[model samples]
Target: MIFEDMDRIVFAGDSVTDMGSAQPVGEGLFENLGTGYVRIIDNLLAACYPERKIRVTNSGISGNTSRDLLARFQRDVVDLKPDWVSICIGINDVWRQFDSPAIPDEQVMPEEYEQNVEQMILQVKGKVKGIFLLSPYYMEPNREDAMRSRMDEYVAVCARLAQKHGCIFVDFQQMYEDYCKIRHSTFIAWDRVHPNRVGATLMARAFLEKCEFDYNHGNGEVH
Candidate 1:
């Protein structure tokens, strides 16, 4: 596994990462990690690698853009001193351009979004064991669609940063695009943003794949 025993992973992002996770920081007991992929990852880690006591924390806030996350990155993410930091922002940065077009200042342009994400990465690069950069995705499979096309630009930015920083990159946009090829976007997310349980599971699986998670690690062992 990419993560060592007792390593702590903090997931920081927007609503998709939030999904009812505790305010500020969420971890330990109950649904503090929210009902999203963060929780799923925690569940699977504990289930399959029972001996590895990896800590999972969620610092996601709904309706936040990259700009917002950057503002609180230090307090919410850095101060915690997690072994691994997973950033899943940029969705709202693109969403505002379409949903609230009238509020020009509210929108986080691609350039600004890239700067914000890069700054966050720089803050934790040498301080952590590893980082996970999860791209912001629009569920629309049609590449030509205005929103999806705009979103692709952000994904490219994430890919670029992840490579430059030597971070583990999870291309969620491409993952959903592949899934949408066989199943409609509505099957997972109706608005094509907030994912249902199935979509969250798919995301968890994709993330674990990058982490070298062994689903069969506990196989043939008596519980």
Candidate 2:
């Protein structure tokens, strides 16, 4: 119950966070929240804490990097005046380095990525009650994998910033790494990026854990 009753949380990130969420801003009824972890989070909050009535907004955009998110941070995040903001970017920032190695301009280096994320934290930390920094992940299980290894660097950056800013940090890379021990990455995502429903649920669970979500507590009863 880190979040107070009626507190609004805005989730900002790339396609993993977007997952086909409504355009511009995703909130309200129907499938506006998309089918990703964001939606799963909304469902869990409603089911587990109906009385809290938290407002969840999705501000994720497909193929966006840290640079892109920072560009729209004001309009998409700050303007919303949310009580909490959860950022889950950096995947494409690392992906572009591999998928489009030839396009040097398309890639965001680690230094710049760190700066962008840090800048975001600085901008919103004072405006919100709490901030959640979700590390970007590469679903590959092997630590020796080039992409996975490089992604680890970004994950460390997020962890470092989270600690410095006193924000809640969710290590999604580690989460997937642990899950891969029991189930292969392909079982959840074919490309190891965009997750299917199963993978999304795993992410939702991890996020809820950080929020101190109680699945068994409901209607004045703790199951």
Off by over 4 Å in 2: 219-223
Worst 10 residues of 1 by lDDT: 214-223
Candidate 1 C-alpha error for residue 37, in Å: 0.3
Model 1, 111: alpha-carbon shift in Å?
0.7
Q: On residues 1-223, what C-alpha lDDT tens digit does candidate 2 reach at each position?
A: 7877899999999999999999879998998999999999999888887778799999999999999999999999999999999999999999999999999997999999999999999989888999999999999999999999999999999999999999999999999999999999999999999999999999999999998788877665534
lDDT (C-alpha, whole model) for all candidates: 0.95, 0.94
lDDT of 1 by residue, 1-223 (tens): 8887889999999999998999999999998999999999999998888888899999999999999999999999999999999999999999999999999898999899989999999999999999999999999999999999999999999999999989899999999999999999999998999999999999999999998888999683635
* Model 2 TM-score on a 0 to 1 scale: 0.97
The most accurate candidate by lDDT is 1
In model 1, what is the error at residue 27, expressed in angstroms?
0.7
Model 2 Cα displacement at 157 (Å)?
0.4
